[model samples]
Target chain A: MQCFSCGFNAMPGSTSCGRCGANLSLAKAPIPVTPPRAGAVAKRILPGWWALNRRMAPLLLRIGIGEAALPALAVPLEVVVRPLIAMVQRPVSLLPGVPFIVAGHRAPGWLLLAVWIAVMLLALMLHGLPVIFLLLVGGAIALHAASALQATGLAYRSVGARLAGIVTCAVMLLGLFYLPLGWGTMRIVGGGWWVVPVRVPASFPPFAEGDIIWLDRSAKPNLGDVVVTFRPQTLRRVRALAGQEVAMIDGVLLVDDVPSPWQSALRPLAEGVRFTVPDGRCFVLLPESYPPGGTPPAPTPQPTGGWPYNRQPMWTVVVGEREIRDAGGNWLPSLGSIEGRIVGRSYPLSRFGRIE
Target chain B: MPEDEDPQPRRAAAAATAPAEKDAAHWLRLADEQRRAGSHESALRFYSRSLEVDRTAVTGWLGQVQMLVQLGEYPQADVWAKKALEIFPQHAEILSAGGQAKCRMGALPEALVMSDGALARPGESAYRWLVRGEIILAQRERGDDHCFDKALILDRDWLVPLEAATACLFHNAPAKALKRAQEAVERGPTSPRCWFVQGECQQRLGMDSAALKSFSRVLELSPQHLEARGRVTAGGGGGMWRRLGRLFGGR
Candidate 1:
């Protein structure tokens, strides 16, 4: 017969392949030899039981009193138990870049080292001659007691399974006791403490969380502040505060005597438009997009009676009222009628850090 | 062979092997049907069976709690309410229902605490605030005016301040009563009790004319307004007749 697994030649009556240890007899079809008479069948069953005992007696005796089996089980028990104790006593790592010494002695690093040394010493004491010998003897006694108990039908398994179960349980019990403390130490040392209590502002649409802002907190906010306040709504910044009643003649913002230098910057945002910063308000303009290179555009003579500028609808800050409006001239109430003074910001401390 | 075969064995086998996956859905439907039939005891059984199949079914837990409340089994209701809260702490309906259960149990302090948590969530309903006001009134009735004042501060539109202010006219300092009542009226002008309070405060202050006018206005808005009508009649109102005469012809 050819064994399929290792392609080894086997004897015709062989039940297993000797080379690769594969079952070969299972592939053959069952062939009935003859019909059984009642008395013969009953005798066949009793003989079959006797035959099974004859085949199993030597194997059972060899295993039940085996000298090699004890060492084989003990080797595995030592291999599993020692590593588990070592794992519980292992040290935790601290933060990077910040030197360990400068980060202070009270940090998580020192705490883990002390625990690791104490556990290692305890484990070393337990692994010594008398302790190891006692554990081996105790394990064997427990196995024999469990086997005797199973023979009396109190349980199904012998003491070997019970001792393995006990060692596994002890490892788990020790792990449960120490693993959380070790993990907690590792987390503390990793330096994620800054995340505990920083305030994060609610996000409004169109403006993402990363936008840069310049906060102005001087005196009472003039029309410039209202323009800046509206910029969060418009997603743009205001660059110039053209004084009240400043006329924009031919795309230039002029505050009475001077043709404002900021007018050119404001042109890109609102072209060919003029707006009066209402009483108790100042006109705000976007900063110049184009640089001042050559001689500036020649200032044209101002018109006399009729103002040559068209008024564009823009936000106005009513001083006592403290109300802000959108460009469409409707009240936006949820922002609250009060002008919330620019107290502080909700932003990242570093480029890598998130706004909490 | 077919005639002799026993169907009972096949039936037993099928019963033993039926999939448990369908049990939760079946129990939930049965609970709904029982609830509709007004068999709350049976409904509770089915709902509990559904929960046994899936412990975290929030709706089933809430329904069972509400059914227990309807059955007046307050101790059991309290237990389920707590369990529902543990699952979804910020659920508004559960908080409100739990507040109601606590209120009925005369645990007003705990009820107010629960309602306060509910109100702190963004966009909580005004009805929850109203229940909180009731809890405050309960505290005030027990001679704890500080919590009542706090409730008024949390929700100025609460009607309890008017009732508490009227109670104050007899039991408390008149000045505090008048101040609280005036604030209540201003905060909730359309409220008949607010006007009734105004009348009570004015009468306490000996301003009969203003008191009479306030009472009259309360009656105009709510003709069956009991306290204001009682105050008017008790305070003696030939003044009311005189005003009536002026309205007709004989002023």
Candidate 2:
């Protein structure tokens, strides 16, 4: 017999529609998949990944930030993962790039993935005052694993409804995946050291101009310790770590209104300028003075000429967050981006301020 | 007199799903009946006859294209769609039929344009959304689940999911096809057509036992379902495992 609800061929005595779940006995005509208009369209097709992402946008919006931050976990997570990656990488170099493939990209994706990995590795190796990279790259791989596990676990969860609920729950737990891993790196790795050599030509009162100096890579600077560092070729001082307000009042360097002790050569232009430093960043005396204007001045790589290095007063130095890219996708300087400097105008002057 | 004059459409709609009506548009009713009875060639002839009876009836033109596509005459369908477009250029159903024909003929970019044209037209129907979803799936992207869901919301018919599953099954995505088929089953658990489609999808996915259960359900729901009966008997006794062994060739 015909099912009245959906016009399906059903058992002669059926009470409801087997096709549309409509009441077959209602005397109501089955709403066979008739178009609101007498339209005829054909067979339906399945969705693609690109379309699925569109469907999952709400969940992805919240997940995107955490996913973007997932690479950060690599830094801290690497403390635990380092051994496996390090040894395996010696024989099978492809192992480090596995996370990118797992997350779904191949060649071009590897380029960004490698850079992220480098950022995490640098955070671990630099031991800078702002050290979050350990939690990014290394932890990224771990985060993926954790989120994967979380998804599988949630799929089996009685409370969860299909893939959507599982994915939502999985993203909710994205950040927590790196915490314990970070703890292990913090508790076990403790800290390490780097002995850097330097030519302090100008700070002669503490030491001679040509005197060589070594600084610990992980140590917070102290009195008599030189901190102007640019790797093996150059050594720099950490002028002021994150929060201290710094000013050069009338050619005299002052930290928190007190005359500073470890002074790099002071600049004349920085007569009364003062500002507090932001987190994840530090203030360092620029090697040169900058002219004041609405438009910013361009900065050169480094003065080929030696010290009596022009001691420019200030540039609010910022950690070069992952946005260091040229139009052609080249990596900018790995060192911190001094937003106040006019370094090739890589950033918007009004927004990130000019690199002087 | 007013009661007697109460609209013919309401009563017709009440029996609309029944394929044939005693007093309806002459050739259009015959075309619908032929299409319903699974004779695409006969449906195409009747649709052409309806168009001859009334050239302004866009429904006959759409039916002609639909039946041509069903008969695998994609080029003819495209030609009809173009001729129909010349007459009713803004008709969403004609545009959608053109898109479907173009997609079947392997002209993806043209299909995309036609599908987008259908979507741009004002007359919103589940057909437009379903066509758009099919076009998207033809692009080999996997996100049309939402599109199909939207179509279902527009018209809560079991045929929507069944059609969606059939599309996926034809496109070599049995896993996804099975999901769509399951959606159909969810909408109409007792439907032999739904069960049959689900069984086909499951067979494609190599889920033999599940496919068997679905086939059995089809038979139970509609004892006269010849295809379901054939599938059940074909897999009867020892041919079951042998059929199951040809997993990849299921599609």
Candidate 3:
């Protein structure tokens, strides 16, 4: 017999190999094998049809879409292959302006860039047709792809590869830095900042028409904080915090029997309006300055006569409690009545920071 | 006295009555039946047929607008509601539907006005209240849950209570959500969404056993419910907690 280890001829009935010193008897029963469990064996050997039926046929007992869709879980290999083949055959053309970018035609690039800027400006100005936003985004992607593809080509060309490679690296390095910057900015202002362009007729003297203001919902309002309320769509300043007794006496506002500096800002208050700010509530005041002919210049003309003239004051004080009441009338705000504090202003570039 | 009346005049009157009775009214009844049977497509078709027969039918316009809303076609619903408004200038139902469509289309201010107008009218239905609640909620206004309660009070046997339960949960009022969920379960026992709300409420209340039962029932009803299956896999099996943790934003 030949030795399994060295392939050397061995004498008959030899327990060990002669040349290689191998144990021939050990080779008789090699690698002791254990049979797998029935379920595992069945899973490994069953045909696709049989396996699918075995898994899903029992779902007939259930009410709705039961395990009948189990076959979908075992995705066909071709499902992945087909998409990959299609992608290779006709790759997405994100590089729409590659010719201009590669040829260094600065005009085309500048023109595309201008289009993007104009789209953004229009979005901010008109605030209509959000579809422009999608177009702007697509244009940006096309620009980026064109630049990146051109950089790749320049990196391979021997003539200007050194300069082109440096430019490409710089562009990629800047892009890497932008990821964290985008995340930080989104965290800071996402859904918390809103811009007001129109001179909200409610906030006139301090906030003029055409002045851009930023509303910061994250900032907690303090006593005397100018905030926006949307009920009657008016802007007001928080005159009193929760649990403070606020009263307007003779066209003057007082908190806890003490007049605040905001009293000086008031046009004039109506007398005998006593409001004790309840728990979880604050008193807000739109100084009589907002009416047709009040001080600080009313932004819009007020209607004369009837219910508006009878009960409504030029400067309105909304008593905040379980519900907001205007001059103790029946009008109440829906929940989430208060918008946010006017933390900063941006439109009037002359006075472009925090509001006093 | 009857013989004195000409037979031709009486026959002509009868003919006019039959045609008038068989017009838009007949098509509207069929649309209502289809809507009740959960055949929304057929119901929409019948509603259009009714409108074609008589463009002045307010109920036909309302039904079509409602179906469009259900299908998430907000723009079309808004157009149909506007048409309805032309016929019935101050109709509460049309205004409520228009408000809802406007809310979905991101016109919050306009939607608020429409909802206000609807609520200002007397004898408003539960649907109008529900739409108002949705508008308030979309605005992120405080106390939107009160509107949901108003809708429930208007009509308890509707999906409005289930939505109210969701709103309560969103506002962090779990006890109130449980009450609404209980009402929803009583009204719509066969609906998986109602059962799902009940399960969520029970889970929030720390009633683990009852929550588990509710989740299992959801799975038994619809085995393909991935959320229910996840809950079962996590709570029933010890080792699957890691997978559940990964799936439910543990990282």
TM-score of each: 0.21, 0.36, 0.32
lDDT (C-alpha) at residue A330 in model 3: 20
The per-prediction i-RMS, to one decimal, reads 33.4, 17.4, 36.1
Give lDDT tens digits, candidate 1, residues B51-151: 66654455566667756654545434665676566545555656765775555444544566778777776664434554455454444434335544665
Which candidate, 2 or 3, has the higher TM-score?
A: 2
In model 1, which runs have C-alpha deviations exceeding 4 angstroms?
Answer: A1-356, B1-105, B116-178, B188-191, B200-213, B220-227, B236-251
What is candidate 2's TM-score against the reference?
A: 0.36
In model 3, what is the error at residue B172, expressed in angstroms? 11
lDDT of 3 by residue, B135-159 (tens): 6665555656677778888886747
How many clashing pairs in candidate 1? Answer: 4
Model 1 CAPRI rating = incorrect
| Lowest summed lDDT window (length 10), candidate 2 chain A | A339-348
Point out the worst 10-residue segment of candidate 1 chain B by lDDT: B135-144
- TM-score of chain A, every prediction, order shown: 0.24, 0.24, 0.43
lDDT of 2 by residue, B164-244 (tens): 787777566778778878888898786677888888877766676788888899888888888778777766211565565
Query: Tens digits of per-residue lDDT for model 2 on A1-356?
Result: 77432347977787655654545454433211121111122111112321233233324334555243322322212122222222233322223344445445566346644664666554433332223444555565654444333323332323323333335324423333345556755564344333333234443222333443333345544322334433323333345656777776655557788766544442222456666655655544333322222223343333232333335312222213221222101111113332111111111113221221
| Residue A4 displacement (Å), model 2 | 32
Q: DockQ numbers for every candidate?
A: 0.00, 0.02, 0.01
Q: Candidate 1 — what's its lDDT?
A: 0.46
lDDT of 3: 0.58
